[model samples]
Target: MLVKELKKNGLQVELKVNIPAKDVTEKLNQSLIKISEDVEIEGFRKGKVPLDIVRQRFGQNALNETLDELVQSSTNEIIRDKKLKLAIKPKIDVKNFGEEKGLEYIMSLEVIPQFKTEDLKKVKLTKFVSEVDEDDYKKTLNTFSKVQQNFEKKDGKKVSVGDGVLLNLKPMYENEIVKEAQIENKMTIVGNKMMIPEIEEKIIGSKAGDKLNFVCKFPSNFPNKNIANKDVKVEIDILEVRVPKENTLDDNLAKSLGAKNLNDLKEKVKKQMQGELDNVSKMLIKKDLIDQLDKIHKISLPQGLVDYEFNNIWAKFNDDKSKGLIDDTDKNKNETVLKKEYKLIAERRVKVGLILAKIGEDNKIEVEESDLKKAIEEEIMRQPDAKDRIIKFYTENSQALASLKAPIFEQKVVDYILANIKIEEKKISKKELLKK
Candidate 1:
């Protein structure tokens, strides 16, 4: 066997490999003997087929299969012997293969990037701060108030927006009944088109005991794919009309939310809002920091890593489409455009990841067991069935749980950079701070 390096460019390497014809033939003969033992002819019992008969029946296919298996097994051995850290599967092109000639092939692969990270003190970042205002407090209070609102049946009046109406609704399209149900305590909201839009529109001019036959077209882009863009007629009998009664923000309302009093609830809501805003502010700062880092320390990323990142992003893109977040019509174009855009983002991520990984290694920023457990606990809290399932998942997939350590390492590196760099805090309005 002979090995020769053809090209070495950054992470990519091309190598020419050659094996002697004698050795190749010996392996092929061995494989043929194994196949002969496994296969049986009509005239012979099992494990007694002749090599000539086996070759005649299977023909060249057996040799090809044998060579394919040998190539894979040999490739693994060669890569292990060479000590190459392949980013993706190597591309193999068979240059020569014959009875007398040796097995010759060229293998191209991308290895891990080799570069020193930029100095921590060299990267500069700015952190933004936003103060909670009256508008924030008012919005939080309004949300709590809406949750505590009460409703009662109203009589001798037309149903309008914000009024909860009880009715029996039968929806039909082309004389075929699509949906039929006795809806009690159905809200007569004008904007919520998902729930009986046409009926609710007619209910505005209808009083209690009014039987309304509404001929209206369902929204062309309705969520229910089966009935979308179809003309539907709804038969609605308004049994009761109820108005929304605003409940006073008192001790009872607070107690419903597990709070002692209105003021205590308000304070809790404000604290929660502040914490959320602080996190958002931190995210904005992190983005700015990355942008600065990209501008300063730029490097060409390995194509294989970029492709892997692109696949991850594409999976998320399809997921968003399935969730009805993105329109089906825009799926193909959106995917293509996103692929290009995310390719750039993916390359940046790879660059940043490589840099952070090297930095962690150099600085000896090790991830402790406590740190991993805390991170796993945080993930578990995000899920509804946190206890058994999350623990089981982490226990089964050790490598997957270990991936959580990367983000922690990156965060520590970022923190180290922030501490060394000159980051002047900038106070801005909520509107201004949110703007890119």
Candidate 2:
């Protein structure tokens, strides 16, 4: 193996790496063996396929894996040896690859800019401060009561609003029973428009055990196109109806919700609301602090990092636009204009990010596992209905976990800066504090 620096222009370093053919063949063989273990042949059982035969069937895939593993391992070794603090991920451009010719590639690296942190004590920032209003606290209490609602089977003859009705459904399309659309034991909230608005409306005022027959017209772009743009005959058998227990704001209700009493519940609600208000205020102050830091430090932003950020922003914008979610102002902008504006935004973001990172390095600030656990726990509290899904998403997706850590680290650094800087808190109304 050989490594040589091809170019060093500003923060960008281009390296040319070459691996000898003998090592390449060794790696290719190892990959073939690993892959062949699961491959089957006509005359052999699974996991007993011959290497040559596996190569004959899956050679290209094994070779591709070999190249990727060799390149990534070599790059990691180089990055570790050089103690490289990367601003953006390295780009690899293959020059040559073959069993006999070995492998060669150019790896372009973008290193983060190193800078000394300036004293932030002189930087003055206005911090917006507010508390949860009485009205808002009451509203939150009402929300909590709604969340704690207990549904009990109704003894009345007819289903009413806010009642959960268990029912079976059958849809007929074009004189054929739509078995795929049939459902049983589906508990739907009356007047909540389950599945279809018309179905819920027709089911209201109906008694349990009553059979309902109706026709529902679906839109052309409905998920199930077989029934889309057409009226389908439907039959429903109501199994049971349950109505929500009244939400009584009292000590017993608070006890049912795990609070000591009504006052404790209010106190907890106020504290939670206040914590949210503080987060909003902190975010506003952090932005202002970052803007000041950006102005104070005139480090030459790495072009590669700026370009990477710009591409990400552009990709997100295009994705949103493709979904018809672009605002009128951006929708009217020409591509050239949008690109120019996004480029500047990207440069600012990259510059600020580099500044925060340098500060963290200088201070040895680190994100602990506990911080991530707490963050995930908070997310579960906010989205209790999607708790399992949220946990699965972060636990399974490495990129998503990294994204979660990025913000946590950023906020920690910001908090450290705030502790040192001068902040003037101005009492503001909740409306002013929360204004977008």
Candidate 3:
């Protein structure tokens, strides 16, 4: 066995490997012996065929099988011996192979780029610090008030903005009633923009027990494909109208929400908001640190890795476009422009990912069992109703578990870097902190 580094580029390598003809013949013989045990000759019993006879009859077949196995094993051996961390599977091309001649092949792969990380102690980062204020508290309380609002039945009263209405709705298209378009006792809030503006406009000022007939043309980009861009006649029967009762942020309201009193509720809200602000602050700081590192340490990115990431991004973009769900970032760009933009993003991501991975490897940072368990528990807690299903999925799917572990490892790496970095806390107003 012999290995030679044929070409070396930044983060990419091509190697030439040669296996001696004696080794190839030895492997062929071993494979032939294994096959002889199962092969049957006309006069010989099963598992009793001689190796020479088996070779005479199945020489080409056995050699092909052995060559396939040898290629993979040899490539793996060379990779291991070279200590190469591949970004993607190596491309193997057999240059020469014969019974008398040695086996030779070329293996090309993109490896993790080699670079030195800047000293964390010398890295400077700005951490925005914000304290929850009265405005935030009041806004949160207002939201809670809306969440906890009560409704009082209105008898024979006309529908108005902010009033909730129950109705029976039937939609007809082309003089035929659409299937699954009939709903009973559906509750809708006026002025909430839940339905199209035209429908809401026609429903307003209608009293209970009134029947309204109207035709509405759905927008071209409406979510329901069946009704989108189509004009449909609608029959609405107003069952009842109810007005929301004035809500007050009092002790009873707080207690109903599992708090002892209003003060307790405010304290809880403050803590939750503060935690959210802290997370935002930490995220900004981490971004700054990564940005700094990306600027200071420059290395050529692997085209294969960039292409892989770009393909993934483009696939998702196309999927979103098919579903009529283009995000703000990609809303108006043409496909060619989008591809160019995303290619840059993919390259940056691959670069940062490689750097962070190297940092984690250098520091011996890893996601421990306890960390994984805690992450799984937190995920289960987030979806308490589907705890059993989530647990079953994580147990049965190793890839899903790795997906959960990746972020944990990345965060651990970030924390390790932050611990050694100099982060300057800059106090800012809550408004400024929340601004994009």
In model 3, where is the ten-residue run with the lowest total lDDT? 175-184
Clashing pairs in 3: none
Supply the global lDDT for candidate 1: 0.77
Off by over 4 Å in 3: 9-11, 33-61, 165-241, 255-261, 314-341, 383-402
Please give, for residues 204-272, the per-residue lDDT of candidate 3 as tens digits. 999899999988886777666877889999999999999998778899999999999999998899999
* Candidate 3 local lDDT, residue 70: 88
Write the residue-wise lDDT of candidate 1 on 1-436 in tens digits: 7889999998899989888899777777777788888886899988888887877887477668757876797789889998876778999999987547858999898987666777666766667887887887887788777887678877886767777777777778877777532354465443445475655667776777888886767775666777877777778888888888787777789989899988898889889877877887888877877777776676768898898988897788778877978656555675567677778788888877777677778878778888889888888789857678888888899788777877887888767666667887888877777774
lDDT of 2 by residue, 1-436 (tens): 7999999988889999999999889999999888878776788988889888888898899889999999999999999998988877899999999999999999999888767867776578999999789998888889877888777787565887788888898888888876756778878777665467667778889988889998988667666777777898999999888888778889999999889999999898899889999989888987789889988888978898788899999999999999999888897889999999999999999988888988898899999999999999999999999999999999999999999999999999988998877778899998998893
Q: Is candidate 1 or candidate 2 better by TM-score?
A: 1
Overall local distance difference test of candidate 3: 0.87
Candidate 3 — number of clashing residue pairs?
Answer: 0
Between prediction 2 and prediction 3, the one with superior TM-score is: 3
TM per model? 0.70, 0.65, 0.78
Off by over 4 Å in 1: 9-12, 33-37, 43-45, 48-59, 98-100, 155-158, 168-198, 209-238, 255-268, 298-300, 303-347, 360-429
Q: Which sections of candidate 2 miss by over 4 Å? A: 25-66, 97-100, 131-277, 428-436
Sort every candidate by TM-score, greatest first: 3, 1, 2
